[model samples]
Target: MKKMIILFSALLVLSASGNQTKAEQKADVSNISSANINQTIEILSTSNADKSLVEKGVKHAANLWRASDGTEEEFTAFCKENFITDQAEKELVFEKISRNIEIITGHFNKITLDLLEPVHLNTFEQHPIDNAFGAYSVDSHWMNDFYQNKIAFIIALNFPAFSLGEKEANAKNWTRQEWAYARLGDYFTARVPAELLQEVGKMAANTDVYIMDYNIYVGHLTDAKGNRFFPEDKVLLSHWNLRDELKANYANKNDGLEKQKMIYQVMQRIISQEIPEKVINKGDVEWDPYTNMVYQNGKTIDATPEPNERYQQILNNFHANKAMDAYYTDQNTFIKRQYDGAKEISAEATEKIFTDFMRSEETVKVGKLIQKRLGRKLQPFDIWYDGFKARSGMDESKLDAQTRELYPNAAALEANLPNLLVKLGYDEERAQWLGDHIAVDPARGSGHAWGGAAKGQKAHLRTRIGAKGMDYKGYNIAVHEFGHNVEQTISLYDVDNFVMNGVPNTAFTEALAFIFQKRDMLLLGITDDSPQKDALKKLDLFWSAYEIMGVSVLDIRMWKWLYANPEADAAQLRDATMQIAKEVWNEFYAPVYGVKDQTILAIYSHMLNSPLYLSNYAFGNVIEFQLEEQLKGKSFPAEVDRIFKQGRLTPNQWMVEATGNDLSAQPLLKAAKEALEELK
Candidate 1:
């Protein structure tokens, strides 16, 4: 989901000042020394506090106390005064801080939601001014303000950030309040300057715009023999729609192979930056992706390939993230911050999980099964083979017709939200409450769930609706996004504390989304009567996890590559990306598909826009399968409500609490094995 804007606006703030380089942003040196830390700890030793916590907190505050913040003496005095030793008073202070931060973050989220409407929603024609406004961050300097006013030092001295290891080792014994305090500690762990944060925000906005408007008028595409394969008005956004279209053609009896080949060619051209510039987002020209040729009214014309803009965007994102490395001493690189700090899972462990799972014998078994079903040799695009789902056998045009009749526009979808909830076994009153809290909007791009930050603000569900109405693809994605909205609502509204009002990470939300997405047919009153339905579901989940895991590994390795070659230009980075994509594919995918040197794994749009996020979808599939198993023979709505309300526990902790098992791929692998046996 594109929920980053809410995060950016809520956590970071803007400074009303001039642009500053990285060195200039880090000009304020720490004034506190080891002597100051020792002195402060000694002064606080008389209080009945944990000595270990005191030492950690004092040292943490010392490191962040800048010369501009105060003198060493003043730092010592601030720690002495602000540090709470009494349990009752400390709890009271924590509660107050939680309330204040909720107010601050909630309002900032609202501001960003409003400012981004023109760009995010299909409300009007987008202008450069709209993008500028959308990119303007209001909270970029809020952290600086906090430090300047001594609030940051107060937080640091009280609730020092815990390492991921510490949290995992000790959190089982901690209370809910202590866990909330730990989350609070995470906020001030870094000190990125306002200007750098703003630049990051602008880059994020620019990439969002780029990814959103990247539409391909597939109807205008012509094959080498000048044959049209798609309808005249069918436009698709890359690479989501393109991939879906490829999947949809699996059920197509007429020209399905040719269409899949055409789409595959289009994807390769996009990844290699060989697509004609004039053909993108424009239907005035006919292009043959296989020949890399452009035509106007039956006349071939010379066309320049896109100038490595895709790779350039990735370079921009890398530089923007790399600029903050100096400030994050604890997690020096963006990779560390993303995995250890944000995801609360180490990158090493995540990679091993994916690679080990991808190498499993079940992968080859599943691939053989798919190939048997298709009665053809496996192609690179078969990675998205969709025949396992009930909907895969049905005509997509029929599903589109049904959806369009049901939901003619955003308003129609909004009106039917409560009913959709009720279909999932929610009672009328509860469904109304959820539907009331979620507001649907017309999306300019693929729909996403932008969750509400505060209780009063409504969560916005941006859904793409064609001029005719909501198509089947849009409805399916809408349901998936709806799952995110539901999780966002339950976690926020039912959690015990405001500080804990969310999932542990995006993966948890994605798990819920997958759960809802797989139920799209059920929601439409279409049930799979096959006795093999359960096994089919397992195989589907396994195949999907198998596909995305490779993509996620590629994403992680590419970031690592960029960090190693920080000075590489766009073309050089593109070459590196291509190399890494092939390496990953050959290692994990080639044995199954009997294909090598296929770079289709690199065709994911997330590689350019959402960094380090592909892993969540793979992990989410794992979580989704486990959760589905847990929900069997239980009250579906009750189980979902109860599990999600646990809210923001550490990943494994949350999994254990919800499913009586830790997060692992073993469950899925075993289930898929059993499924293969049954299907065979």
Candidate 2:
């Protein structure tokens, strides 16, 4: 997941007018008419300096100026007083605002991080009060307060927001400072109320807590005969750990297929919300996922199925985001805000990218290769096929043992960060410096990296650590999160402009994480001397991309389904989501996997919590492949440092600068084709 601060930033801003009462509508409308805008523009034009920028700024300010802000005359006067036309003075003002905003937002981020500690980290026992604290958004009122004091008006007047098209079209020739100006201009695009922002924040926090706390006691899972299939103490979180465990079982010759099948059944129950309520996060009860039966003390008992809580949570999110529709006249729907506003990539373009990749012949070809390797017909769960990875053939238990012994806890991993970076080609001093800026925490959920909001604050790397130690899966995920920390630290501390810190989007960060994750074996000092290593890596990237692209497209379709049926209750939403999942599967995946109507695509927990985020993983795979191609013969550390420091350009511009080409799936597809031929 991206930083919570960054995610909430998406929910805070929306432009124009929508469904409201007459009085409310009047308040939302800009009292500044065209006459006021023209007058302000004319007054500012006397300087003959930054002529186009000044005009754009004035119009933008007028559009956002509300009746609550000031009268038309006062609006015009404020713009005339605040508009900075002198080049040097404007730059200086930008710098000061940039520095101060960083301080304000950074401290706000720290407050949230501190408040959510009990909920997000394993530092202490969770309590109801902690949830309240976690959900209490301190910065929710910041924008509203700014608007009341006309600070937002000043910024909007001086630095107007740019459309994605405008930034992309002109970014190639722009300097770093110009890019920073564009980003600063993006600060205040709309004026959502503090109440609406607070409501969304509470919904998001609650949903996240639900997801993180959802644990499935796999050890208690039984077959039809009440036979246990996993270790007695084994437990896995829904979706992430379960999926990883399924992937890990490929090396278990004794019962790998059966385990995968069992996990697949468990996932089906979760998506359909047919799993017993007592079994969730409860180790005291035993359940047969295949039969959907619950047992206590070896006696069968009537158990209630989860009462559509999963669906209700997502519906709650929909309603929370939907309430903001009246405020966002330009991008009315939450879907539009998520894609175009937050991800800065249009939903249509993102969907096209995934669908195009899915339709490629290489996808089916790779499925056939996996079937050949497995010596069985492909199952729906084969989407997680792990044979292409370098470590696939190695014993997973041995890897787990090694990882546990190598790093027994979060502190161990924290101390070893510099060593891992040094192995990846960083010098000792630089590695130590980078490590010092990153903090490690035991995550309550699977794992995620939280980037620092300011220069001095540390980026947090969080992963699950057990009583024994960090397992191979946790270590692998931690390494990925560490990659995010590396990028986060570098981008924040190394970028030329404060406002330009961080990558263009979460996909760019995920790209770096994937890049680091692929080198897990090397980081463990395990060398792959296989001549086919390069080809295998290509196939792995291709297959992973193919799998997630389908899920991402499914996510998009589910949201589209919800929009079409906005009055949908939880049960109705469940049925429609299942139908949409089947439709997507049958269209894109059935031929490849030789299966029809699989709801596994709906199994991602992200669909319920992080709306419209699955596409980033798909895009990350593409960007990672492109960057890997770029890094083939270059200095690893130097290239990564230089590329990440480019910071927050549009997707294509960032790709072109980093890899000498635009972001596309073609490179991965082309490589996978060659890999299949070579392996054959």
The residue pairs that clash in candidate 1, if any, are: 12-139, 13-139, 13-140, 13-141, 14-139, 14-140, 14-141
lDDT of 2 by residue, 572-601 (tens): 999988998999999899989887989999
For every model shown, what is its TM-score relative to the native structure? 0.98, 0.97
Shift in Å, residue 245, candidate 2:
0.4
Residues 1-680, candidate 1: write the lDDT tens digits.
73753232333211122222553355355778877789889999889999998998998888787777778888888887899999999899998988888888788888988999999898788899999999888667787788888888888889998888999998689899888888888788877777777676688788889989889999999988889999999999999999999999999988888999999999999999999899888999999998898999889999999899999988888877777767767687788878886678889999999999999999999999999999999999999999999998899999999999999999999999999999999999999999999999989988799998877988888878999999999999999999999998998899998878888778889999999999999989999999999999999999999999999999999999998987899999989999999999999999999989989988998887788889889889999999999999999899999999987788999999999999999999999999999997
- Going through the candidates in the order shown, the clash numbers are 7, 0
Query: lDDT of all the models against the reference?
Result: 0.87, 0.86
Off by over 4 Å in 1: 5-28
